[model samples]
Target chain A: DQQVKQNSPSLSVQEGRISILNCDYTNSMFDYFLWYKKYPAEGPTFLISISSIKDKNEDGRFTVFLNKSAKHLSLHIVPSQPGDSAVYFCAALVTDSWGKFQFGAGTQVVVTP
Target chain B: NAGVTQTPKFRILKIGQSMTLQCAQDMNHNYMYWYRQDPGMGLKLIYYSVGAGITDKGEVPNGYNVSRSTTEDFPLRLELAAPSQTSVYFCASSSSEAGNTEAFFGQGTRLTVV
Candidate 1:
């Protein structure tokens, strides 16, 4: 069963516009949520994370919002740039597991000029 | 610091063949993990170790084994290869701390099984 799901397989946005990626989870036990970005032939790099205690976390151009009651989370990048084009994976830390993480299928975001 | 390094960036194996995917980290992290990413799929944890002499299975642990004899090295072993096991494998490490759960990943190892 896929506890974490990224319904959209891919997303596209024009450069200098808003690009939002969404993720939903069925497991209520997950307390920590994270987003990672990956380029071709490279490993997934950590972007940002939000603890269950906080509803939102921001890092410069990147921001993550969590809605525990809705079981949803999102990553928003304003004024998306060409360099932002890549595969994004949403992950959650399993509560019972010892720092083990579960990831979503991923959403391929394309930022065009 | 080289961070996390994984040897054999690519490999191919026939049925019943066995090989070791070696991973080493320079961060001196006490926690290490091995995960596989199928095409168009998310990463699934195979095995992880909090420290040497300790290993545990994760979401997907079939047809795989791992040993962490040292703090810097964690090798994943495939006893018998299968087509289903063909995927990109990643090795990650992090210090065993609450605020440091963010992981550092290696370049990744692409394995193809026939």
Candidate 2:
């Protein structure tokens, strides 16, 4: 069974606009969540993350919000640039699971000029 | 630094064949993991190792095996290739230190079974 789900398969937005990607999880044991950005033929790269203790975490143009009670999280990239067009995956980690990560299907974001 | 390295970026195997996907890391991380990504599906964990000489199965460990003989190497073995095993494999490593939950990944190895 998939513990993490990214219902949206794709998203398109104008450059310099905000791009939002949402994810949900069914396992409440997940205490930490992360976002990874992947380019074609490349491995996923860490983008941003939020601990369950906090509701939001921001780094420059990227922000991650976590709602533990709702078992949901979202990634926001403001002023989306052409380079931001890629597949984004949301992953959840349980504290004692030896760092095993449960990843969502992924959301393909396209930034249009 | 070469954070994580995977060999045979692309390989094609016949059914019933067996091969090993090599992985190495120079970061000296204590935790290493193997994951496979299928078309339109998210990455699924195959196996993981906490340290040298220690290994454990993950969500999708069937038809696969792994060995962690040293901190720098974690190799995945496909005992019998199958059509369903055709996918992109990724090797990742991360430090177990507190406040460092992110994992560094290799470029990935694409394997096709026919």
Q: Report how far residue A57 has shifted in candidate 1, in Å.
A: 0.8
Q: Give the clashing pairs for model 1.
A: none
What DockQ values do the models have?
Answer: 0.75, 0.85
lDDT of 2 by residue, A14-105 (tens): 99999999999999999999999999999999999998999999999999999888999999999899999999999999967889999999
- Weakest 10 consecutive residues of candidate 2 chain B by summed lDDT: B94-103
Q: Pick the candidate with the highest DockQ.
A: 2
DockQ of 2: 0.85
Cα lDDT of model 1 by residue, A1-113, tens digit: 99999999999999999999999999999998999999999999999999999999999989999999999999999889999999999999864467888899999999999
Encode model 1's per-residue lDDT on B30-91: one tens digit a residue.
Answer: 88999999998999999999999999998899999999999999999998999999999999
Fraction of native Cα contacts kept in each candidate? 0.70, 0.70
Q: Measure candidate 1: CA RMSD.
A: 1.1
Residue A7, model 2: lDDT of: 97
Model 1 sits at an interface RMSD, in angstroms, of: 1.2
Grade the docking of candidate 1.
medium
Instruction: Report lDDT (Cα) of residue A6, candidate 2.
Output: 99
